[model samples]
Target: MPRLLIAEDDADLGPAMKRALELDGYVVDLFARGDDVLVAVGVGSYDVILLDIGLPHMTGLEVLRALRARRDETPVIVITAFDRTPHRVAGLDAGADDYVVKPVDLEELAARIRSQLRRRERRHDDSLSVGRVTLDFAGHVASMDGEEVLLTAKEFRVLALLMRRSRRFVSKTDLEGELYDQDQWVESNTIEVAISSLRRKFGRDFIRTARGLGYMVGGLEA
Candidate 1:
């Protein structure tokens, strides 16, 4: 099972999030203090770390800075109730993979977690590209027509998965878990909907569907 570290100060919310993620099949370690988090991170094999901005002993931002200073590339996502642009900017610049302003919807938070994990996986892949779409695994971004195509968090993840294995069918269930919690109960068409939306944002020809299989993004009909 995947391991996750949740650094949250709220007595109630922290455990709440842990319970939710644990039932989703992740082995979660919850910490209410930043100093403890720092210590634990240095010694633990964490696949994902869900951090809150407010923390005792050390600020969450301080912990994040400390982790990045040591070149820890483990995905750290800041989940805070504060929705300020300056704070968000600081978190990303400090090496956070993503941020969520609370009170978070459990389903959405799970989706964000799935997206970050998949994104990290894509980084270690050799390379990903299809048609005009060029994905830089090292740089962690996608491009088309020589322009950096702006993609939402979910869009980038979904596109990366398909482009990494171009000409292959990706089933909805395969995508479902990677984009949501196991108990989040997304509709079967959730993958289809997300893909359809992405197709419109990009170009319809960019993604192809194989009736009973799933979706593919790459190459031409020829």
Candidate 2:
């Protein structure tokens, strides 16, 4: 599942958007203040951010500028009631990847999110190859040694993250965040179970574990 952050101060609209996006198969974290958004982005990773311009404590443009100053390239779509030309220009100039006016159409918002994702993915190859294993992100398929490997949705997501960060350990906590949303109930051994299942299909040594550091792929010895 893709992770998203929503910064909207409207008490009702915030939750409504969160729920709707969640229904669209995204793990969403909602914040009502710009300061809180900064805090969240500092510690958590998100594929996209939906920002409201008039947020409390700090304006969305301020947050956007701060992120750009630090070179945080995560895609952001500014959402505000002000649809004036200057407002839109200011947002684009501040490094917003896209902009949307208030009273957003849910379907259009979803499409915009997808577009951002596709654009980001294009920054890298459509597929990843590590040893004999290959993951075709565009086709949503995995294969090993020219043979197709079956994977459930959760399993595929877990594998994608690990393969993308190949040669680097991905902590279990990070995997959990990628696999499930806050509202979902996750088993203590959910990651372990998935890892074990993947090893069964891909070969026992395909993935390696680092006691406290977590798991990784592309560590196969020659």
Candidate 3:
């Protein structure tokens, strides 16, 4: 999991922000002062930063500019008390991703964090390796046991989605949505056929059936 730095100067809001992000599965580091944030940012590899524009020593804008000057690409969402037009624009210009005004909903803040992390995930697809199975999306290949297991396009798409979100049970409907036209008349068991095909081409144990729940695709260790 990626870490988040919550740099809020307000005494009450800072701990609240920390609790919200921590509940959402992020390892959070809190800094009540802007000067403290400068030291915190250098100490850790933060995936996203929630910065308050109004601060004691360094304003959020100055910190953002300083970070960008050092070529830091960590996504910074300016969580500011300032609702002025110039503040928002200046934050964006200073390399902030989005600006959230004060008195914000923690759920929406968490959603924004998730959106940024997902964008970063898609940007870097070095490869998805699970146990002995590997899904090379760019090369359009699935290899196991040091050999290419020839797969159809639909098989690849189904496998890719599962591999991307491996360890979770992907429902039949979700996989169907990924494989076919939404408006088209496809059989209810179309996904079953695809799953069966993938299992045959790869290995019988490649994807596990969860009875009525859905399909679990990947090794247990993966």
Top lDDT prediction, candidate number: 2
* Model 3 pairs in collision: none
Worst 10 residues of 1 by lDDT: 213-222
Candidate 2 TM-score, C-alpha based: 0.61
Q: Per-residue CA lDDT of candidate 1, range 84-117, in tens?
A: 8999998999889999999978999999999988
How do the predictions measure up, each by TM-score? 0.57, 0.61, 0.56
**Candidate 3's error at 218, in angstroms?**
33
On TM-score, the stronger of 1 and 2 is: 2
1-222: candidate 3 lDDT, tens digit per residue: 878898888989999989878887889998877878877765445778999988789888889888776555678999987898998889999999988998978989998999888876775375565557787778888898668888878777888877765546788888888867533666787777888998887778878778676877543323
Best by TM-score: 2
Clash pairs, model 2 backbone: none
Give the lowest summed-lDDT range of ten residues in model 3. 213-222
Q: Model 2: which ten-residue window has the lowest total lDDT?
A: 213-222
lDDT of each: 0.79, 0.87, 0.79
Model 3 ranges with Cα > 4 A deviation: 126-222
lDDT of 3: 0.79
